[model samples]
Target: MEKTVSAHHACVRTAFENTVPAAPPTSDDIWQTPPPAPAAGMLDVCGRERRLVTRTRERHTAVRQLPDSGSTLENVCRTLQLDRSTVRRFARATSIDELLVKATNRSTILGRYKPHLHQRWNEGCHTSAQLHQEIVALGFTGSLQTVRRYLRPFKAATVAPPARRPAPRPRRIVRWIMTDPGNLTADDAADLKEVRTSCPELDAVTHHVRDFAAMMLDLRGDQLPAWMERVLADDLPSLHSLINGLSRDIDAVTAGLSTPWSSGQVEGQVTRTKLLKRQGFGRANLDFLRKRVLLTP
Candidate 1:
């Protein structure tokens, strides 16, 4: 049975990520409407980002062509076999580039060691081995080859760009939103607060998630209807998918949430049985597999 309380955090995260601007926006240019593409060859957008842009463009065009009488979020989700968040994102984006910024400009893990790499590079420490070892000692954990690859782009340059706020991945942002506020570090809390302030949609979703978390933690399945109603009142297409699924089997979902009974033990037993069966397949017979499954801890 589906849990009484579930969230479409991944869907919401993807939708939110599409809204991140490539460059820092001024107060007057929130997200820049259509952020200009980076200068060609200045930054390499990996193949995946290009493919994502193409796919999003297709969805965006499809949603735009939907007839007026059949263009509700639910209808779009059903017709396209996509989640609500995806439909909403595609329908609302001004351009495909809006969905491409994060993939192109997101912070890389090697970013932290840039200043060190640059200072050492300029000081004539051209030896990859020495440079790799030096940065490793300074808390760099990347492979030596990564250092070699990045150096190619800065081979002739005597400088690197100034550091900027590291863009946490969509999944990381979702985790920050889903986790209990009390469990987050001060830095994480502060960053999440800033993110919420910048994007009111995310802020609204966070509120819904916190409320859902509390209902689940307290085993308060009785409150699900109220929670769902509140969520529906907002433009939260991401969560609507979860609500739709739960509404189909509300009793079972409610019982699953309000009680501790679950299929966990049964699934564990099945998994162990498979492991024992595999272990005995070539080395022994069915009897051995059965004995192991039955007697082994």
Candidate 2:
């Protein structure tokens, strides 16, 4: 019975196999081809418009290309109907910090001149003429005035240029010691008072300087005219001696003071000097430091 059942199953399978036929290869089977066009109405996943990309050759054929060098300032101005100066200015703006760096660099050239000037001056070669000659040799065609100004500090050193190693510059030491104002406090006023009490002449000088300071400080707005009158009326001789003939420049001083401005600028500068001194950092010489602070800004 088992053999008869197996024979029957085999006969049925053979009959089913003979009814189905093998399929021929389609065109896609031979070519492995892509579709001719996208499927109808397919939307991009990102919801943005789908842009078709092209090969380099296709892109070149689609648009006109301009020559790279054709965008010069003159050409750009003509193309955009704009002024050439406007474009030039925009292109040439190098930044304030860049300008500052360049100026500082140029100023540092004078630093080189410092050592040479000192060396020459030490050997009794110190003269405006000699220094100017050396500067001229070094390509400084500016003027004798420039040379004079540059060499002035060396000549003013408290000690002559040393024949041995450079003197531990007292001026530089003073500057380094004095750059900060930490000690110039109420204590300074007390000390100054004590010194004034000990020396009669010193006391007189101190009082004069203080009065001058008070006069300058008091000159503000409507109070300025009254203040100036008081100062100018007091001991004209003493005023002359304190500020030289600058006391006679009364009108200019009054004008400067009357309009909310005073030698606050000058006093502020002196304060900066004392601060710099306390900080123990200035040029190697006090005179040099003085000139630097005055001339730098």
Candidate 3:
């Protein structure tokens, strides 16, 4: 009886052990909680990590801001700590037509028929589609009909009537002359005077130009000596600054006094640049023109 009872107890123990399977892993199973995954970072094309605190657009990222004191393109570029390429791009793109094309590109089509388009498209009979078809014949896979539709918007976008692109715009023709007060005609000067008077800084700049133009046009060699002596003796800061800037250019400035040549050679080069630019018909870039000019020389 004792043996049978002992055997029954051993069987019960074995049944209990068999009823329970091994438990799954709990907190004790892990060696350490894996460090939280590194916060997501931007990756470059090469798969290198680049962490930017905050993303900003390239175009909106200004090197510096101007006080809007009516500076020239060249001055604005320098003051703003910007590259000339960017400044020229911005300056030449003031017009809606110029700005619009960049926004919508039909430029690739226009390149082929450039100088001719200035004559033909300027005359107004040819449609953009017609032009596109012509280009298609030359192997452009782009939609031919879309050309006219693209160009149609430009007609309305021009700054002045019949394709006169004003500031920050590149029209089919008209080139930008300097915006300096010295560059203006008498009528334009008077108008700009009114404009300058409303802005004190601009007024100061205009007055400066007026003085410089007077000195350049009125003062003869003998007269210049007296005027320059007065400026030097007076210790005028503005005059000093002007002289300092122009001192390096003394040869160019005084060349007319000595020889029959003024900046006519330089002016001729500039005219050639403008003509070469006209070949680009407002589309040619400085590098392209430079290549042609440098290569020609």
lDDT of 3 by residue, 12-52 (tens): 22232233222221233322432111111123212333323
Question: Taking the tens digit of each residue's C-alpha lDDT, what string does model 2 give over 51-149?
Answer: 321222222222112214456666656654557674453344333221222221222333334445556666677678877776566544567776677
Q: Write the number of the candidate with greater TM-score, choosing between 1 and 2.
A: 1
Error of 3 at 74 (Å): 24
TM-score of each: 0.55, 0.22, 0.25
What's the ranking of the predictions by TM-score, best on top? Answer: 1, 3, 2
Clashing pairs in 3: 93-168, 94-168, 94-169, 95-168, 95-169, 128-148, 129-148
Which digits, one per residue and each the tens of the lDDT, describe model 1 over residues 162-256? Answer: 32334444556677888899999886787677667665767878898898888888899899999999988986666778889999999998887
The predictions' CA RMSDs to the true structure, in order, are 11.4, 44.9, 34.4
Q: For each of the candidates, give the backbone clash count.
A: 0, 17, 7
TM match of model 1 to true structure: 0.55
Which candidate ranks first by lDDT, i.e. highest?
Answer: 1
Off by over 4 Å in 3: 1-190, 221-244, 249-297
Q: Compute the lDDT for candidate 1.
A: 0.63
